[model samples]
Target: MTDTIRQRAEAALAEVEQVSAVVLAEPTDANAIVPLKDADKPVGAEITKRMAEIDMSDTQSIVSFGSNAQAELQEISQSMLQGVRNKDVGPAGDSLRGIVSTIRGFSVSELDVRRKRSWWETLLGKAAPFAQFTARFETVQNQIDKITEDLLSHEHTLLKDIKSLDILYDKTLNFYDELALYIAAGEEKLSILDETDIPAAEAEVEKAPEGDQVMKAQELRDLRAARDDLERRVHDLKLTRQVTMQSLPSIRLVQENDKSLVTKINSTLVNTVPLWETQLAQAVTIQRSAEAASAVRDANDLTNELLTANAKNLRESNKVIREEMERGVFDIEAVKQANADLIGTIEESLAIADEGKARRAAAEEELKKMEAELRDTLAAAKSRRDGVGDNAGTAVPGA
Candidate 1:
């Protein structure tokens, strides 16, 4: 598909290169050559009447007498200039030049290549670069189509104007023919004045009476000045014809350009746009296939990793569960801690009992010592009192 467009594009460019130069047709109308168009029109009766009233004694009046022809020639020149202006191709040319490269850019953009996406993005679905490019490609395609439509419309206008330019080309040639007739007509008038009127007056001057001779000579001088002015007007009209000639080829060139633009625009619309769309579609299809394959491979790899991790976790969990199942209700470490705590309580109680017993034994021994001392003291006193009262006691016992 790309090759097809390339071939067509090369052909289109060749069409532009081979656009033949515009060959303008020369004037061939018998009426334009024989009977002058505007040149044959009679001058105002007012101007002709005023010419008689002007005194021959004034040289300025004589020289400026025949000026209607110059006025008409100037009018023709202005009309020709306006016609050229009306047929201008600048606007169309600028429109073509501005958008040609811009439209071409679309056909050769990054939309042609499908970018590779990273593996990690598979879960993010539609996050691939190719997916983004598909969206971008769609937007670009719409824009190109829009531009193509606009250019095709413009080419339609250009085609019509190219035909219109041909008509204008002919009209410009007609202006040239009209200007030629004017120059020729003015020269014919100048010829009669120079050959017939001036020679007759000069011969009459040699033979007329002295007073009438001076009057005839003044008339003769006025005739010669009028003739010279007419000739100058005719020369000026010839210059106007030159302007018409130059405008011919310029119009043809514009028409030629319009033709070339039409060809190129047609090629872009018919060939380039469709080819680009095909390529973009193909690129998107390829990328989608690649992404599907990558996503599947990526999903499989994830599944395997998850299974391996689950197996490792299952092994650890089973070992811990079996150890729990095989054990007694109380752990030995807790029992040992409780047993040590009980022994410390018992030993402390026994030490307290032993200390109390020792104190009681000491107390018993001290009590015995004290009691013996007291008894000894009392016996001694009693013995003394018995001896002293032995006599009195024997008497009291008798009483």
Candidate 2:
């Protein structure tokens, strides 16, 4: 094993050895109390057995744990590539994409109820404004309902994902622990092969070429190869363990994001939605009251203005009748100017109509020519593509 891996394994084993036996409770019987050294005997023996069980020459998977494991965790690393998202992706990509989509779905609409309300509705004292507001309010309410429904749907998905992550979190931790133990055991086995097995194998190979010398050489080669393979296997397990460590934090970040989403959704539903509804109700009530008051004032103003307008109309009518009687039927100059204007207008209109017809005809011919050119271009392109495909599929004659 490499120095780095050896150090890590040694440190891990040292930590394990540091854990001493603990007394669960005070013993009532004097005989029940055992000395610390005696209590540690079983634990030390188990650790020894564990270290002895690591067979360096056996070429099975590292995480096999002598078949205590079903799946080997040495292949659990796509980490050399990266995490799901890179730094360039803005604000935690797919992790929060669902919540982001739901939140960003919120937008504004041009619900100009007043513009849609007719002038006559306001001036002629009708309930058209109230009807418009009520209908628009219903549409707004429906939009709110849609927002809630969409959020609820996203929440359901979040809940399911969170539960799945909880299970994954546990499995990942267990795998990491198992991989660490495997690495420590593999490291110790490598040490033994180097100090004892390799020296012995080399010594055996150094003997004279007699009495199965070829066999001894091959056995020495195999032993060294096995040790090298063990080192590489231990290295891979270390990488797998690192990846599992990264996964632990990744899982936690997702869980925290899920929690934040729940809080935001609850705030929208419980606080913001209810507050908007309350304000909308109050504004609608106030607007209705103002419209009713305005209608009463408009009625009184209309009555006063009508009484004054009748007197003014009589005075204007007398003056108009006198003025019309003094005027001539038609001035000669006015009639000539009227005829000239009418003729000029008709001539201009006719000229424009003719010019439009000629231009339209020219445009139609040009469009037909363009269409033909386009069709020819497309057909030629298709012919070239077909020729290329045919040539590509053709094979050369060979011996």
> What is the TM-score of each predicted model, taking all chains together?
0.50, 0.54
- Compared with the true structure, all predictions reach lDDT values of 0.62, 0.58
Worst 10 residues of 1 by lDDT: 31-40
| Candidate 2 lDDT, 265-371, residue by residue in tens | 54555456566667667867876787787779879999999989988998899899999998889978999999999999999999999999999999999998996
Off-target runs (Cα >4 Å) in candidate 1 are 1-24, 27-128, 201-219, 300-399
Q: What is the lDDT of residue 122 in candidate 1?
A: 56
Q: Can you write out model 1's per-residue Cα lDDT over 254-363, one digit (the tens) per residue?
A: 77777877776766656666776676688678767876887798799999999999999999999999999999999999999999999999999999999999999999
What lDDT, from 0 to 1, does candidate 1 have?
A: 0.62
Residue 123 miss distance in model 2 (angstroms): 20
Candidate 2 segments exceeding 4 Å error: 1-130, 207-211, 326-399
- Write down the TM-score for model 1: 0.50
